[model samples]
Target chain A: MNFDDAVRLTEILLGFAFAQQSIEHFKSFPNEQRLFIPRFVLAVLLMIGFQTAWVAGLLFLSGLAMLHRFQGPYNGGSDRMSLLVLFCLCLVYLAPTQRWQEIAFGYLALQLVFSYFFSGWVKIVNPEWRSGRALCDVFQFSVYPASESLRQWSKSPRVLFVMAWGVMVFELIFPLLLLSRISLVIALIVAAGFHFANACLFGLNRFFWIWISAYPSILWFQLRFITAN
Target chain B: MFHILKLLLPAVIPSWRFFDVIAPSPRIQFALLNSANAPSDNDYEWCEFRPRPAHLSFLQMLGRMFWNPERNESLFLVSCAERIVQQPTQHSEDEILKRIIAELKTNHSDSTGETTHLQFRLLLVQRQDSRLQQQVVFHSRIQSLSTQDKT
Candidate 1:
């Protein structure tokens, strides 16, 4: 974490993506999720888990309660089992370890790699997806509701062709971009634009934004660890 | 640096501990095995622990089928084998068809296969559907099951 990176982190904690954009965006969007309120509260109460573990435990449990409440009555036994297993896993992570923290960050990177590749795979296998209609279908997902102009543009043969190619190029070789250090920057920038456009255009909920921003940190962590190893 | 990342990106919660040293501004990873997780026990990366080959697990192989069924006909092959083994004598293709259908109706519910019972249940339906292709199991001389059945 360099000086600039430190600045980036402070803004993130303050719910600012970057200084200028954060201010502009914050002013525009007053009522979305506050990026750091809960964490900020937890940090202050627990003093960052340095002095008291209880505060961290309470915060973790409260979050779990909220998540469970949202799911509302598991109809399937399998889903219940999956949730139980997941909860047990989270408990295992709270143990203190310098090394474990490193692994946690690595897992986040793996999530990024897996999600892009898997999502791309899901698109590729579908015939509808291969022909480019899949992109339209995906865009229609509640995440990216196309505006009338965007919808009109989507129908153009040229637009469809470009969309088809873009989907394939972005998804098919997604994993490779992550693996190759030099290419990742390219992958990240394009992917960010993709998500940002989706968010701005369709009001798509991109939890993926937070997920991906964390990626830059992950790669830095991974490189350091590999060198140390 | 660690302190700075924490002081800065609190919502950016590091998902795993793997990047503690290099987290650009402190990082986050999800679904990781580490000491941050307690009660569940596993903390080391799979590479660090056991250090084994990357063979696919049984469930993983089954999941591949859901991607596309035609490519995986193992279920069809097994059904054909079972019919041949159980009623080798019933020759006339019509009689065999009847027998197979009967077997299917009687055994509509699939029995447990290794890890999860659901695999067998899923396979049963697909196998029944494939039987329409009537894939013959090589040369089997059916001498006439009518006489065998009645007399």
Candidate 2:
């Protein structure tokens, strides 16, 4: 699909993800009383594909409140990704025309690109990450390790180094892959596998869905900026 | 400019300490031990009421969310524990532990109907070669609970 279609699809998926994460009463009943009502309303609007300015405004606020309510983003990357999508969608609905809406989507794409490059660059500069010890340590001491067998992979220095370097290179080169359709497709596949492994081994299920929701934005960016030419 | 800043600030800011730029060596783990000195694997066990949904299926995302060990409750407690450990002063440690004990007593009293002392401990866990090693870097003195705390 094209950029507009991609934006719409992402909004729908993000709405569902937010709804699932928020359905339970994470805060005490009295504490959540103010947030509970607005959140459900926002979820309903997004689910039904309604993107009015009011809805958007409420969603943007409720997303912030939910993150705050959860004691400031306990889920880490998933929280950040959700906020990015919510903020962009709010802008999309508030924009006066299709052109302006696309601009909002483009901003989301840039943020996603920056997130990948920033995370990878930091890892590259870190001594532990460069030595492959970071990946090994994660597997060994992970609180949510899926099984003992999974953690055993840390035993092999060669495997650890390759996997560590693989992650760093993939993330560092992620933005470059957006310039070509074939390369973007390959990168997307590799990225999906990476998230899948993380979800399975580390139980970071929310990260898997939230990050994938941002993929369409990158795809839209490529279509608008590169493939059209 | 305002709109742009709004979109960028949260994205640029690191939301969770775990997602910090630098992955430190020898990560930390938090554990709660009962007065009997036995460690319970379930963190929620100490909480008076474990949060659950109307239906288990709607709450369980792909049967994985429920099993996620890194629940927000524990993460929040860990953050609090980290702050307490950083000071390493008797007065500060006592203050933090007192606050934590009060929280536990308030939250975990009614449902469990069990009176037990609890201690919060932080473990410095590291991996070397094929083995994982851990030691208690910081541990709170046990906070004993009275039967009267069974609110």
Candidate 3:
């Protein structure tokens, strides 16, 4: 994908994610609900590619206001990723030159890679996660389970162990996939499926949309930098 | 200036470490109090507020990606409870306490009219030795249910 195509796809995906998130905020306090109107409007403007630099800047500011309202991210990783994507988009559109835009966009791709790598690195170092105890505990006791029935997965220790290792290995090796276009495509597909399963099991629907929104940038980064090199 | 920076730090600096360590999850429980400032005997049983549903269909799960207000609100409550556990400040406690009271009033409208006061506690749930254990971490002082809440 070219840089412009990547930016457009990112905008569309982010627009949908932001719109969904805005609707979720309607269930919050009146002040919080008020913020969603402008957010939804900005998201629509972003998806339509109308005055993108201005839309991105306002959206970034709106995101900061939202963080202050919640005193932190309302939803942890997903909110952070959304803010990161907005920040990168702002840089991409507001940059003075195409070369600078590519650099800014590439930085976002780099951060996405680091997000997965760092998550895996932390888990691998923790004894609980390494032994599969963390996954077991998560399924057994975490408040995130979508339903009580989903917790049944905790009963199988062997399955949990293999799943734990599978996640760790995939995340640790994620950066290597960028070396080839086909490998990157396959890696992104697996990552999407992983997010889908988490959404189904934990009801972390926001993570799936926000993370997928950033995938186009990763594809563009691999094609432009990794393949070119 | 320092307070502003403190608020901005979380938004500006992203923490990607997710589920790296599975810690005990917090569950909020509430009990109704009688006019005597004590738990009413019949209403003494603490009930879990906003528990996850026992089951969800595949289509329901798929639809959650676009709209899931109940689950999002539940997650927000979890985040608030987590903050109270991690940082036991008056502000954090008050924030979540108010939310729980509001939720109880909304969800148990029929029971709220007769309930003059309420109290809530935070339970840290964890699995140990192949069994689930709940440890009470914080007990809130009795809070009055105002006329506004009853209405």
Candidate 4:
């Protein structure tokens, strides 16, 4: 993927994510509700790639305002990822040189890969995660489960163990996916599916969109360096 | 510069450590109290605030991907409660308490006759040895309650 294609793809995906988030914020804190209109407008402008640099800059500012309103991120990891993407996109547009733009987007892509690897690293180090106890606990007791019926999966320890290891191994080896085109496609698909399932079972819908928004940068990064090599 | 950095730090930095370990989940439970600063006899049982729905239709689940204000609000409350549990401070506690009271007032606007005060507690629920265990992590002092708009 060329740089422009990557940027466009990222913009479209991030726009959808931001638009949805703006609507969610309407039902959030009273102070935050005031931001919904600007955010929604910026999101639409972003999707259309209208005045790309200016729109991204304004969106970045809006994102910071949102951060201030919440005192941090209202939603933890998902909000963090969204901010990171916006920051990078802002730089991508405003950078004086193409090299700088590439560098900025590269940083975003690298962080995306590192996020998965680090998450898996931490989980593997924790005994509960390795023994599948963590997954069982999440299903049985975590407030994240979308419905009471979903908690029934906690009863099957064997299934939980397999699923837990499956997730950990996939995440741990995520960076390796960048080594080849075919592997990258498979990795993105698996990661999307993982996020999709989390949204379905845990009601973590935000994570699904925010994480997927960064995929274009990953695709661009791999094609630029790994495939060229 | 230092103050600006402190304000910006939480939003800019990403902590990718998600679900790294198993821990008990926090649940908010509140009880209605009578005028004497005690739980009313008739309302002795603590009701769970914003309990998760038992089920959602397939369409509702699909639609949530686009817009899910209620679930997001619930998650935000959980985040607030978790912060208080992790580090208790007057400000954090008071902030959550105020929000909880406001939510209760909005939801139970009809409770004007019997309940005059409200008390809430945080319960950490975890599974231990094939059974559920609940531990009270924090409890608040009884506060006056009124369904009438204070504004």
- The predicted structure with the larger lDDT, 1 or 4, is 4
Q: For candidate 4, lDDT tens digit of each residue in B9-77?
A: 644566688898777899988777776456443456688887888888778788998888778877877
Which candidate model has the greater lDDT, 2 or 3? 3
**In angstroms, how far off is B72's CA in candidate 2?**
5.4
Q: Which ten residues in a row have the lowest lDDT in candidate 4 chain A?
A: A25-34
Q: For all candidates, state DockQ relative to the true structure.
A: 0.01, 0.19, 0.57, 0.57
Distance from true position, residue A106, model 3, in Å?
1.2
What are the per-residue Cα lDDT tens digits for candidate 2 across A96-210?
A: 9989988988888887777777778878888888888777777666544554566677788789899888888898898899878999989988987887777666557777777
Please give the RMSD of candidate 2 to the true structure.
7.1
Candidate 4 structure quality by residue, lDDT tens digits, A1-229 = 9999999999999999999988876655565677877898899999998997898888888877766555566787888888889989988877899999999999899989988998999999998898998898998899999998888999998999999999999999999888889999999999999998899888999999999999999999998978985
lDDT of all predictions, in order shown? 0.35, 0.63, 0.83, 0.83
Clashes of 3: 0
Model 3, span A34-73: residue lDDT tens = 7888899999998898988898899988888877667777
Q: Residue B94 in candidate 2 has what lDDT?
A: 48
Q: What's the candidate order when arranged by decreasing lDDT?
A: 3, 4, 2, 1
Please state the error at residue A100 of candidate 2 in Å.
3.7
Q: Which runs in model 3 stand beyond 4 Å of their true positions? A: B1-4, B7-13, B36-43, B147-151
- Residue B86 in candidate 2, Cα distance off native in Å: 5.7
- Lowest summed-lDDT stretch of 10 residues in model 1 chain A? A70-79
Q: Is the docking of candidate 2 incorrect, acceptable, medium or high quality?
A: incorrect
**Model 2 chain A — which ten-residue stretch has the worst lDDT?**
A24-33
From the highest DockQ down, the ranking of the candidates is: 3, 4, 2, 1
In model 4, what is the error at residue B63, expressed in angstroms?
Answer: 1.5
By TM-score, the best candidate is 3
